[model samples]
Target: MTDANTTAFTNPSTFILLGIPGLEVAHVWISIPFCTMYVIAILGNFAILFIVKREPSLHGPMYYFLCMLAITDLVLSTSTLPKILAIFWFNSREIDFSACLTQMFFIHCFSEIESGIFAAMAFDRYVAICHPLRHSTILTNSLVMKIGLVILLRGSILILPCPLLARQWPYCRTNIIPHTQCENMYVVRLACADTRISSYYGLFVLYCRIGLDVSFIILSYIQILRAIFSLPTKDARLKTFGTCGSHICVILAFYIPTLFASLTSRFGHNLPRYFQVFISNVYLLVPPMLNPVIYGVRTKEIRNRLLRLFTHKGTKAFSSGVGPQTDLPGVAGW
Candidate 1:
């Protein structure tokens, strides 16, 4: 009996994704919202990129950071949504081992990249609000490009080891992943061999990237708030806060669920399987769908441009001086 049981388990070429485990019956129904969110994420992020690129007025550091964010959101959501939809719609649960690793890498790497972008955006807001006169000079085009490269490299370099380590493990137990997508720990936990190295390395990467990013973001915001309160009039403070509204919303949208999901995955071993899966999916899907909406609604510049685009008005050609400079001392054409 022991020999037969041992013989039944072997290294699998493909891993099976179980969509939602105990909630299998609701896969189709649950997919409707997931599919809707994915579509919105794609269209909304692309539209943001298009609007920012075409509207010369938005060629500032804030918008440039926003464009990076939109691009990251696009890659992050695209990495997993299609497979999730396939599992729900067509029952195509089998994912090649290589493909699963690739998906895991993109999902995690881009998530860290997205977090880094958020940190960059926070710095942009800090400079725009705290040192408005030096905003452009400090965040020059060259500096922005460098920041992007650093963010990309940080995420890729730190997360590269996760998949490489997972690849080295011997998965002789089972190939069935209970969640929808190939999360790092989920994949590593299936290994029949010692997983301590991979597990510790994952924690290290998480602290090195996300923990530091969050800390910096909080510091930036605190400094920004202090700067805002130093203004003499209530109206000035209010305007500055209004300018920061979109960014604060976007930051919360991305980090809250991400931190919750990560903590739950690490410590909530007693939680129901379906609940865990649902939260993980929400962490991936919610931010991308909401970011564009939050920015479009809260940012007057983007909103007006979007309205003009849909109204068939002729958009002025791209030019550095075309955008009208604002009168607010601490707000740089926000």
Candidate 2:
């Protein structure tokens, strides 16, 4: 490469993140909702973790996975939004190259971890419904810990190369990333070097790892549906479906916007830049915000626990003189 082509890599200092490129005038206004969503995501996920930890009855494979999911959501949102808000609020768009890469690594790693947790939760549901008698024996505490470890390891190891590959590239072109976050493709495209390998590897990781996880989740649901249908009573079917409803909502919330954003980035090349950035931001922010809401509303145990937590702070005893039910519907086998 020419001297000019090597300049950025040699004196790598900072990268500019273009927050909502064409909407510079509206960034302050736009930040209102973004800030709201960030607060909601943080508080919501924290509540999930708090509820799971405090409620002894929630100690099970399903709630264990829910805790993992909450942690992942917290990490994922925290990894991206602080920088985004800074850019929007203060126009502090320049990020150190190393810092940018580090942010990208964490963003991708936590995202993949969430995907894996979703798949694990689906399997938990499968075991609970399709093999109820074996559920306890199968998803013991040891197995839960092992699965969590495997999910963490899988994301951390696979995502290591993403930042490494970006660091190796000589970014001689303009160092402006046209999105709020340091997504892999956005950063790779700014490199002066040929990025075919990086692009292909990113696609490989997406399809092979996340794709595989999504497929397993789908298959688990299929088996779960079969088992639900096999039950003779309508009440059994409805109860089983109700047990899975929150999970289904969470899965759809996580994946649909992500798929839409991915497809638009790949194929909607002619679409307006601001629209693309909007969708990308939506993909990251919406899932974290919605997850806890879905669970709190759909899962009775979590809802009651959350209610009791708030109510207890106001009074010494229940107003109705009835304690919260300890034998609430279990998450896995309700």
Candidate 3:
């Protein structure tokens, strides 16, 4: 056999992203459903961004964090969805090495952006709950912008090295990425160069940057709960914690699946493929869907604003048909 022919057959250029083994045609079957989710996630988060932007009253730290969250959701879903659909619907599973690296860069960058924003949200919540009087001074717009700058700086710095590590590999034949998108670990695994450095860096950044970020969030909440309980009135205490409950729920949703994915990849990559995709989807889509809901429920003002958007003009007609109704401005806003 010719050398070129041997190399061609043995050295894979790309792998079909056969999702979830044992679920026959896992690639084709998951395409329609997952694509639907991608659309919903993008639209839902965009709606939140639109509502926040148009509503003058939502110009606060919580809303600011919500905006950041919406953007991150778009970033992550964009990173994963197109490649997945290509694999499933069109039988177009091949991705150029450079495209894979590019996807990997954005995926890690945006995931860290979400993490960093959650930490910032926790700090914002701490100030708002623990020191209500200083909430304005503590979470000023300038300060919030600075926090955004930090997220940009930190997320870029953390994820830049992984792609650089990807490029160091000689690509000596193995190009099949096991998953749909170019996840960091899979890219590193395909590298022909020694991947010890890449593996160490990936884990190190995971533990130090994300681990430290989660620590700060938990610490902020601990202090916030203490302050909430020390308040003299039950109503005051409830009101204080209520302000941050949405944020708390969001943080939990974002962190748990990400942490689980990290741990599973480290130890259980051989586990069921369905499990991996399930975790990935939950982590990516749940936050985008829940962020709006959490804010609507906890803030009250956002909920009422949304209600007003739909029903305020129709109120007269509704009263004539179903009886009379009145919405106090304050209650309506909340």
Give the candidate number with the greatest lDDT.
1
For model 1, how big is the CA root-mean-square deviation?
A: 2.8
Per-residue lDDT of 134-241 in model 1, one digit per residue for the tens? 877999988999999999999999999999999988888678899999999899989889899998998887886568998999999999999989999999888778
User: Any runs in candidate 1 off by more than 4 Å, and if so which?
Assistant: 1-10, 314-325, 329-334
C-alpha lDDT score of every prediction, in listed order: 0.85, 0.83, 0.72
RMSD to the true structure for each prediction, in A, is 2.8, 3.5, 5.2
Runs in model 2 deviating more than 4 A are 1-11, 313-334
User: Per-candidate TM vs. native?
Assistant: 0.94, 0.92, 0.85
lDDT of 3 by residue, 225-267 (tens): 8987988889877766656667778788888888887777777
lDDT, residue 61, model 1: 75
- Worst lDDT window (10 residues) for model 2? 325-334
Tell me how candidate 2 scores on lDDT.
0.83
Write candidate 2's Cα lDDT for 106-175 as tens digits: 9888878888888889988888888777778889989999999999999999889999999998876677
